[model samples]
Target: MNVPGDGGKYAWRTEIRTRRLAVPREEREREAEALAEGVAALNAHKWVCAYMPVGAEPGSIAMLDALRAVGARVLLPITAAAGPLLWAEYTDRDSLQRARFGLLEPTGATLPAAAIGWAELVLVPAMAVDRRGVRLGRGAGYYDRTLTAAREDARLVAVVRDEELVERLPEEPHDQRMGWAMTPFGGLRRLGGTEAEESSSAG
Candidate 1:
């Protein structure tokens, strides 16, 4: 169910993001361990789109490995001249390179957007998120643009530390909330579950 909003939601979301930037290093590591374990069990898909990690976000490296270890096809982002985002098949680590942003992307042969729907899962990156599947990104709108073409039933999951999933996040018409928040300590949190929980868990 989509969580209804009133006032103070945006404020809460902002606070959650701030908290993560300030979370103790030890706590962050524990969260990472939980996330890696959970991802290892989701071995029921053929294709996946996941992050390659940059900074404090729950790094997608673990998820990428699980996907590949299960022989699932994986895809990563590619910077194209035509747009702010693009998709390419994951070939090999040697073919990947660091982009202008700290993100690592595929540099092998580019894949058409038409080939995007082939994936059954999309593990996204976000600064913070709410349950409505509308993610609060780094203000880039990169996933917002490309995810529009993802398969309707394909899971759009944002892996974050428990502190990154907020009770109520700022939402605009163009933003997309993820289906679930995969946090480190808390397991799977269905977005917008309850304010008290979202706040305290992420807080």
Candidate 2:
């Protein structure tokens, strides 16, 4: 499967990464805090699948803690052998340990890839996402591969900064589309895909 790593996609990634690196430490922390509060307000979900932001990623550890405080049992992804991602329960900040691919994962029981099906919401990290729900990942295709097992009703939300949410993005058929976008400022914006269509046509 072709990941977004060449040509237009590669250029798009470079631009987003550059912008992300330019974010000051103070602003990042502030946005992260706001993200925590925003994510916590998503109380409809009890079991959530989320990722820990590393390096210049917009979110901080507080995001996961906020999810936990909302009585949601959060499941963090663990990088496994070259394939779909594995899963582990996020008990707390201390339970996370540095792991392969520069990721911090839970040092607890590893669950099967299908464990993601148990989640009502799946929060995925992205460089950028468009209004149409197209997400630009880190050229790994990890989420694309793992999301195949996500329950049909599960809300796939792309976690990105407010500015990172744009008008359009390059999308492939194999790429998993997001139903919502979670940003520090916007909190959660419904994307312009089937979800939006359904919602609009309903009322």
Candidate 3:
């Protein structure tokens, strides 16, 4: 079932996954704390769609709490079959349960994919993201499908470590571009698009 253009993506995923696994646990914890702080500083949003990081992913559960503290009613992805993701409200760490793909998901009532329309901001998980807004995910295509339901004005932001923010990455037609990247130390950076242009001029 391999697609013609997927070989390059496969290689990138392997390399990134290996690199993530090499990061020390202590460093990961520190990055998680910094990420939470970064998310906390963003302008408050009424609704946000975010994910719970697992394994060597660049964030922690605290990021959810930070979003909540910033006045967002946070929604976390709940994996279904092979289409767009379902969502559920994130109440607390205690509400999370083990799910498919080794992900942690909230136990609240599941909402349909269209629930993404409620979010004013969508925080996506990426193995890497380029300045061009090309996000390299784990190749699941889940976010790709899910984000199609996001509100037109919703800000799509990728959460990654500083090193994972690069200048370029392979892109596919079906891949959705992120408008911003949130790094642990670097905070929020505008990616390719109108926002990037505005940020450049303001600087």
Candidate 4:
């Protein structure tokens, strides 16, 4: 489908990437620690799909461990050739090995894309996300393709830095909207979307 404002999306990506790279190492580590604390405070889900933060990403392996400490079984994504993401259970830091696109994935049996059905919470990586839940990804379309397999009741949360959560973003029909934005200092902020209403009523 035709996604309006392609130029705007690209511009946003460039700006965000530049900003992320400029973050000082000390601040990045501090933010990572805060993210772990935020996740630890949440009511643990039985199954949580999360990613290992690499480079300038705002989280650390501690976030995954926090989820585990809260009695959740965590699943990490395994990237493949241009389709929905495969999955594998996250055991410990020892289970992670470097994979394509500079990502760290679990060294275990690969689960099919449909395994997303097992998760109640999916922590997505994003360049930025808006209050309306429009997530600006890296333009690879991995999450756009994979999140379709998530359970209807699943929470799609974008993991970002505090500054990456904005008031607006360019969105397209094919883009999957996040229900929540998890930030280092901000914690979890509910976004405006169908999932938000459902989540609020459920609570």
Candidate 5:
């Protein structure tokens, strides 16, 4: 559902990015740990497509480990030219190396973009996600293009901080809505009114 006039995409991006940057280092770490625990609690999925959160992003190395602890095959994204994102298997923390945009990618074999369809769960990076499931990325269309290949039954989850989940955001025709969101305080929230409970749980 598109909500008119929630601010332009760029402006909303700037505002949310500023808030994320303002988070203290210690707070971020604590939140990352909480997020890891939350993800670990959901052990149903076998293959999960996720990202290595960099800089002030909401996750940590521990989050990936938590997913792996559940015996899931984790797939990380490998940045490519202006097109759909490539994929690589994440063996461990040691397999990661710095890539473009200061992102960390796996050193394993790079898979084609269509490989995303193999995932049962996809944890997407976002600056913020609204109650209606609109995700605000870093103004890049990587996920927007890459997510098209995800299996229709695959759970599309946006990972964001507790406060970053808001009421609404600017949306575009190409912007995909996430089915769920993982947060520090809220474990797994079904967005777009699938579950209307107030996300006030503790982290």
Candidate 6:
């Protein structure tokens, strides 16, 4: 599977190693808090898609819990067609499953990808991303396909570590860029790729 790499697979490996080496619990917590606030703010009004945190990934537990506290119906991703994703309503963590690609997923019945049309917000996962909103995911491009079906007004935020929000990235026309990068401490910034742009040819 081809993916966006700094230059080569080795470079990406190096970057991942560095990120893992330097990320202490303190830094991770700070980034998670900042991300939670930004994510919660954008998701305050509607249904939101949340993902289970993977290795070294920032947790949406805080933000998701907050949304739940406010009586919002939270949703989780269920695999769909290649390079795309689907979702299902989930009220808690109990419905999750350990799945393909080592991703933790929710096993509930699937809702239409079009269901996102009613969503006010969606939080995505990323291995790395850019200030321009270009995300370097695990190469499946699942969110890319899902974003294609999301509501035009839906706020798409990608949860990542602060350092992953860098200068730029490689993007394909089908790739999805988020509007915000909810980091652990750096808060939020208007990112580059948008639902419109992704829908356009600019992705």
TM-score of each: 0.78, 0.91, 0.91, 0.91, 0.92, 0.78
RMSD of each: 5.6, 4.3, 4.2, 4.2, 3.4, 6.0
Stretches of candidate 5 exceeding 4 Å from the true structure: 1-6, 194-203
- For candidate 3, write residues 120-169 as lDDT tens digits: 88999999998889999988899999888899999899998888887778
Which regions in candidate 2 have their CA more than 4 angstroms from the true location?
1-7, 193-203
How accurate locally, in lDDT, is each candidate? 0.69, 0.87, 0.87, 0.87, 0.86, 0.69
- Residue range with the least summed lDDT across 10 consecutive positions in model 5: 194-203
Quote the positional error of residue 78 for candidate 1 in Å. 1.3
lDDT of 4 by residue, 1-203 (tens): 12245549987877787888998999999999998988887777999999988678789999999999999999999999989999999989999999998999999999999999999989998989888999998888998999999999998889999889887888899999998888988788888854444232213
- As for lDDT, the candidate ahead, 5 or 6, is 5
Per-residue lDDT over 18-134 for candidate 6, one digit per residue giving the tens place of the 0 to 100 score: 665678988777766766665555535657777767767777467667677776788877775464567787776676678866676767788877777777877788877776777
Per-residue lDDT of model 5, residues 159-181, tens digit only = 99888888878789999899888
Give the worst 10-residue stretch by lDDT in candidate 3. Answer: 194-203
In candidate 6, how many Å is residue 24 off? 2.7
**Pairs with backbone N, CA or C atoms under 3 Å apart (clashes), candidate 3:** none
Over the stretch 1-203, how does candidate 1's per-residue lDDT look in tens digits? 13334534455445555666787878767776667666666646888877777766775465666677777788887756554466777766776788866778878777776556888877888876766655777666677778778899977788877656655566788777687777776666556555444421321
Candidate of highest TM-score: 5
What residue pairs clash in candidate 5, if any at all? Answer: none
